[model samples]
Target: MRHRLAELRGPGVPAKALDARALAALAANPGCGRRALLDGAGVDKASLAERLGAPAPFGQSQFALTRGNAFEARVKADGGAELLRLAHEALDRGAEPPARARLPDLTATGPEGRAARTALALREATAEAGSWTLLDHPMLALEVAGSPAFLEPDAVVVHPDGRWTVVEIKSFPMLDGAADAAKVGAAARQAAVYVLALERVAAHLAGPPEGPAGAGAPRVRHRVLLVCPKDFSNLPAASAVDVRRQRAVTARQLARLTRVEDIAAALPEGVCFSPELPPEELTAAVEAVPAAYAPECLATCELAFHCRGRSRAAGAVTPLGRPVRAELGGLTTVDDVLAAARGEAGDPDDPVVAALRRAATLREQALREAAEVAACR
Candidate 1:
């Protein structure tokens, strides 16, 4: 029986460390509103921000606690430079710590403490290949962009022919379709950033003339190799095929990497938004507006309490805040969902409006009966 990716990689303590950092960043800066997320059907920024900001009863980190079980698993599922790059990028962008220790202090005892050492061991292995060379080896610096990114992989594998692969280990089951395009894209962009950073370091060491790779030798090409579990629950019966799928995913991810300069330019001056929602849309969607909620809205919003109260006060049908169902032409929120749910919102001849009006009556009746029962109680 073939072994799954997770079995080989074991637990991803390093990955968990990265997630902790990300959660910390989110708390430090909670971004714009949830309206855009509602519109896009994506992750709720407000909820995430609130969760991050809320003090844990036990003084535990929320991200670490919530994702603790799957830290290793997620690391297994995450592929290549993309995930690693995101970790590095998030760290670089967020906090600025004083140089208490110039280097990562590799020999520190304990599993988590020795991450830097494990990372270096992997790099030395990768540099053995003819095509790859761990530039400026055995020296310390603040950024790994100047060195082979993993920048510290569990191991870096340089092919005899000059290609390089960064290997990350994790212990988690691989699930198909659960991975979103945006998440994958973010991972890919991250790896691409590492490649760009390493290339700069490599170029500097080799000296200029030919290109970023150097004039005399062909540039070192890089790939990310994510090791993860083949099946749920660390079952070894699963195969290594999961890694192949991740590789394909990484390829797709490369297409989404925006140039670092471009991303820098896009960021608003002196502003950091949590949840990473688009600033313009966020400003328009949330800000001093009347709150409202519906069954759908309640399902995903942290601001539901506020919205629900507002909706009830307004007495609007569909319970989606102030906009009466009639105003939306007897439909749900968006035009597409409304068309699908009502099927005749735009039709003039159809009696959709009349039918919705009747439904509203029934809803009111139910509310009145409940209110009477409450009074008796």
Candidate 2:
């Protein structure tokens, strides 16, 4: 299966490994088995999507990546002086500014080695109670759908009082003391993944499970520091965002994502996701894996348009949105919905059917009234 997935990358194009943001977005639409299987197998979804005639703009340009890195560097300049100062001012003004913060080396060969290094750094930072420690680009591992996902947060701060904070530095500006709400929400979701990963690490650490002052017991605070450019300036400003609810929801959803092994076990015989296959073959292979397409997937999933085309062609009710689909009862397709609306099928007494009939009648009356008014005019 690994070999088969490797072949799906088209001989040279590297597989787009799932990142924290991708995983979070996958969780945002948790109803797609197609997405789960492809993502878990590290399939080149964008390639498949292109073959299916819907090329998603998921590729981040190197210039944008470099610009983001530069922005983060400017914010974390001078040994993270501005970041920590903003953190203090935003989170705890009473606490004195951190002097002489420790920056540990988290360099390692791979995600596994980096995660181990990060854990070690956290432990050592926790032990030193008199000073502050900043972990930059710390790789944290999370178990998602029975697989390990490595997440690197912008920075993690271990305060003197035995508390840890997640610092999220974004290139987006905090204009007029506020940032884009949607962007902030996305950042919060990404940070929530980090917080959950840290909690998993904390759960395995030694000591009384809860260290002195409950430090050992998952010291990750729910309120994380979100630093962005202050009103178009290169200087960064920070705001404390409480992601407790998002954390709980994301943690639950991540755990509930269908495991790749199970999805593979259920695949039809002789179906491979090789990118070398013809477009028709690829489409057939993808279609074999069922998907729950929704309107929300347009902004997130690469395969959304492919799935949507299939759904619309099949008249599947899900493409119209979940609420409309829910009101349809067992009618899971557009044809069924139309049949009910036209009084050609379904029990008239059924609430869904009855509501549809009433809606249809109202629409007909409104149209007739408008026509009559036009004729009179």
Count of clashes in candidate 2: 1
Looking at model 2, report the run of 10 residues with the lowest lDDT sum.
208-217
Candidate 1 lDDT over residue span 98-209, tens digit each: 1111112255554434544444533443333222222212211112101111233343333333334344334443465133344343343334433443443454443332
Model 2, runs deviating above 4 Å:
1-15, 59-63, 208-217
How much is the lDDT of residue 162 in candidate 2? 58
After the best TM-score superposition of candidate 2, give how far the Cα of residue 266 lies from its true spot, in angstroms.
Answer: 0.8
Model 2, span 1-377: residue lDDT tens: 55555544446656566777878877876778888888877787887889778787775689868878899999888998888788778876655578778999999998899999999998888776556788899999987787667888999988766568888988888999999999999999988888998888877667633334453355678899999888978778889999998898898887778887777777776776766788898888898887878998887788888888888899898888988887788999878888999999999889999999899999999999999999999
For each candidate in the order shown, give its overall lDDT on alpha carbons.
Answer: 0.36, 0.82
TM-score of each: 0.31, 0.94
Q: lDDT for model 1, on a 0 to 1 scale?
A: 0.36
Which one wins on TM-score?
2
